[model samples]
Target: MSKKDYYDILGVSRDASDDDIKKAYRKRAHQHHPDKAGGEEAKFKEVNEAYQVLSHKEKRKQYDAYGHAFEGAGGGAPGGGASSGFQWDFSGGGFNGGEGFSDIFGDFFGFGGRGARRKTNQGEDIQASLTIELEDSAFGREKEISLKRVIACDRCNGSGAEPKSETISCTHCSGTGEVRKQFRTPFGTMAQNTTCTECHGRGKVPKHKCATCGGNGIKHATDTFTVKIPSGIETGEAFGVAGKGNAAPFGGTVGNLYVSVSIAKHPVFTRQGDDLHMKVSVGISQAVFGDKVEVQTLHGAINLKIPAGIQSGTIIRVEGKGMPRRAGYGKGDLLAVVNIHTPTKLTRRQKELLEELKKENL
Candidate 1:
């Protein structure tokens, strides 16, 4: 039987870019991986075989020129010598040394097939929450927070050894930071390089353990620091403090601290994206006659003009009286919604004046 087209196998066009071919391979391989539920082993092998040919530049060129005839000329897939009557020289360690193969399997299996390196001793990041009042958000404030975290050992200076101790190469990895590992997958036996468990990728071990931290290179401690909360910061926004998190073992990089901020509800004002809304009650006479009234704002109380015969729920804008702008040099306007007040009881004189006014059809 004739072999299938590599482009058709990966569901990609013949003119597909290298990135397009890689993406298609990942999608098709994941869909047919034998270990996955409802997966087809035969389809998985076909996808791998197709990728093995098209992924290489020289092999792809040869296949494009001669199609299936290239196999007879020893241009078949890697490691397919003699039995398939074709072979491609991979002295540079084609599948084992190339980044493309390792990266693809890393995405699928969570372990790079080969030549994968990782920072095993890096510290872990920390997450925290901070709550501030609405007024504080309008004016920006500095806040102090406390946390219990891991710090580098003071006695040994994070070296994980006693003050005068000697160091030795890691026997497990023979002074190499990584160790060779073999994982059996549906594809075949895959050789991978993983961090040394004994030395945590440092490639060295302490002859004498640190007394302060018991060879861990770190100690538990409480930390307190001030964080500057910017003005106009919205709720659920986060800020980061570099190097304020846990200290790495064996003197690796320190982690960062992330603080998520939340603003408290204000009693009088409600905020909406740089604008403040508040209710301002005006007397019946003031609404009918149009007068200047004092309205409370974030900065201070300001005089607001009430138009004559104004209806309730009318919004009066006080420019530059709201919260400070976090991004630029300006302040949002304060919107005061007017509410007309009607007296439930009236004095005799007031009642007589209202009665007379009622007769005037007002």
Candidate 2:
């Protein structure tokens, strides 16, 4: 296969800037998102690949300098020969084959349509962005979400018929929903069966249809449900609320609702996985001479002792001071990185002491 021009794939100029490439990718991804029509996963993935390469300055430079020859050489799709940074090993020692690739990019092209489209008949899983305070994530919380969506029509009660209506078998297919014919030939006999597309195999037609749901049993309705978010949950992880998505059309199955968490950004502390990060800024003298200081955490302000001669970027860990494990098991460590503040403007005598101290290091 010929290598496609990255710029052409992303519909950008060869000389486009990183931001331009990013903008193009965002536009294209949104257009091809599975939620929208014609959003084939394959096309979307190609666009992603184009953007991934062009948006990175170093990667772009390498590609421009080497071309597709970079495949095994590490310039194209992350490859392998025992050197690919990508995970190449199979877990469970079984054939995962294309499962991993399809999991992320198969739906990129609408070519992967059967499962993706039938998923519509199955109803789509809906995701809601939920923001909770940091404390809420540490200790679980229950949230009630209210929304409206199309469900089975309720007027006909999914029967697709009027209250006084009667059903009759389809004459065309003789209630079989299919028509069969025998064609006698010189050699022998030939038989063929054809399904009646009109009745769609139901074989019955209603005399009158329900007005409210237009003969369908379900209806569009506002639904409300409370979901419990587990404690120690990390942002971006999802929780499932069963039978909460839009009702399937034509009496199909209801979709599931997946609520993705977005933890409110903290003002004082930052979290990485189970661990917490705190940048404790200290006075230059306090850092050099060591002293006890108070710091804020998700729980509360706690006293932390600093060792003498603490340097910027130095890390001090407080065991079990961080967040709890997501599974409610072991606790994480709170790591404090140091930042020493030097007085910008000091008294004449203060300046003299600092200058003398600098001379010692010098």
Candidate 3:
């Protein structure tokens, strides 16, 4: 049986440019990517085979000259090598099992399976606590905090090399920063790649090492940062600052600094969610007849109006006086509970008047 035409399989004209062919292959690969749902693995492989031949100028020229017959000489077609008994093998490449060929395609299409890529040596993240007053939480404030953490060496400038020192490429790995070792196993010889020990994968070595940080590229020191604590931030909530944590040893990215908020307890008011709760004591006359009382809020002291015939434990709401909302504009309501304080002892004249008024039902 004959094979399908490469142009017909890719749905492109015979004279399509290299860029057009690449675009067509990319579109088809996205549609039939095996990682996606309802993707056709067989069709995906077929498209790859077609692209592998058509994308190369020399291979495309050979295919145009000899068609599928040229694949046998190039070791591409499956059955084309049946006479010679040679077949396509993936064991030589690392894409045989884990991560598979999708990793290579993923690098191009921004997908997953990036096993062949080098792992980044990122610095560890750091934790810090910030103590702020309740009033500061109600209103946002900026605070400067001193922290002790790993920072890049100022003398060496993170290069771990002395000033005016010359850096030379590593002789062991030939500046590739990797060393390959072959082991003779029962099955066969297996080769493994590892970071060069002589240069520690830096690909270069300095003639003179830095004396300040001792060629470590980093040091422990104190740092000061002015962080803004947003309004309505509660206890245990954290604020993150990018690239402000520990410095990486090499050229890697610096980690993040997480600042946890610890709001101090208020002396007069208790907070619940976004609302403020407080108790105000009023005399018997103030409860029977309306009177204005002073209440302490985070912003300032405000007079709360008490209604006539108010009973003890009556809750009065003062809108927009509590803590500010976390996400939206406006403040929560302040709930004030009235506590009526009755006099323990009364004067002789007050007792006589109360007795007469009670008898009169006034």
Candidate 4:
């Protein structure tokens, strides 16, 4: 099907109030909400799309610049699902009677809450994948990440109206914000009750529009937050950043952020579960005669004693040289696999001595 004019579908005007758009959404969502038996999910989504666009400042600017038919340029319509392959489920508001609008609108837009939200509901948490070094992950770290999203426009404060301005009665609905249209069709005079286009079913209009945010309270911005990662965190582990997710519309609480960790690969040492692994090379004489050697670890080099007559492929354990275990448990041990090196060439006397020693051993 062809795309419907966003303003026409929502019964709003080129310049409508946020309250107007909200009332429009509630009206259509009530009728087209999936719980209504004959309701259409697509129509309900169209309503959400209209709100997501008209309610956000950057999106509204793009819509205003391109007139609701804005192409996403190269990327598509941000996260509104207007890009393509969008799904619409309507079980919110009084449509489901007990269902919430948040679920239905969330299918397209990322924000949470519908109409008005009560206290509680810790807000939705968002997960982000961040790559850090083992040193950083081990000792705890602070990092700044850039998040591109729609937040409340600093200029309008989510009201979408100019500050110090007032709202007056709507002209189209005669203060009802709704109107019943009567048209003389081929059959007879057909009448339909729909939201008013002039005031968007709000029954009011702002006397002045905000110049900074253009009367739309939300702005498209790059939000940067320095996330603090706790020590002793393992790879692929997750952390939380409170109140960092999408901001709730209509003065609701902000959402949270979740970050997934990825530690970098070490050059000389390998990690397995909390233990470190490394290869140690020793001369043939030292392997056979037992010697004390210095081993490398994350902290520093430590001395380890090798047993007499030790052979190649032998593993030596150095306790407490690995990563700290979670839950305050004991740390892991480092395993040093020994490799015995042989002399490639020897003098006549050395060769004679080696041959005599080999014969004696035999």
Q: Which stretches of candidate 1 lie over 4 Å from their true place?
A: 1-9, 12-46, 49-118, 220-222, 345-352
**Model 3 lDDT, full chain set:** 0.72
For candidate 3, give the lDDT of residue 211: 88
Query: What lDDT is reached at residue 27 by model 1?
Result: 97
| Backbone steric clashes in candidate 3, count | 0
TM-score of 1: 0.66
Per-candidate TM vs. native? 0.66, 0.49, 0.60, 0.52
Descending-lDDT candidate ranking: 1, 3, 2, 4
Where model 2 places Cα greater than 4 Å from the true spot, the runs are: 1-124, 130-134, 144-148, 152-210, 221-225, 249-253, 262-265, 345-362
Clashing pairs in 4: 57-218, 126-258
Give me the displacement of residue 302 in model 2, in angstroms: 1.4
Off by over 4 Å in 3: 1-121, 171-173, 179-202, 345-362
224-313: candidate 2 lDDT, tens digit per residue:
778787877888888887777767544557788888888999986798988888899899779879999999877678899999988889
lDDT per model vs. reference: 0.76, 0.65, 0.72, 0.65
Steric clash count of candidate 4:
2
Backbone clashes, candidate 2: 23
Flag the better candidate by lDDT, 1 or 2: 1
**Model 1 lDDT tens row, 1-362:** 12778889999998899999999999999999777998886677678767876887866775676665534433233354322322222222223343444443332221222111234677877988889888878888888899988889999998899999999998999999778665443355445556787777889989998999887688889988888787888899988888888998887788888889899888999998788999999888998999999877889877899999999999988888888877798998899999999988999999999999999997
Which has the better TM-score: candidate 1, or candidate 3? Answer: 1
TM-score, candidate 3, is 0.60
Model 3 lDDT tens row, 221-248: 8999888788899999998888889986
lDDT of 4 by residue, 1-362 (tens): 12666788889887888888889878987888655888886676667667666776755665666652333223233354444223232222222232233232222232222211122223345668888877675557788888765567676686556888887777778888667754332112323344565555567756676676565455667898798876667788998888887654322366788888888897767778778788888877798899999876777888878888988999888888877776686677788888888888898997898999999992
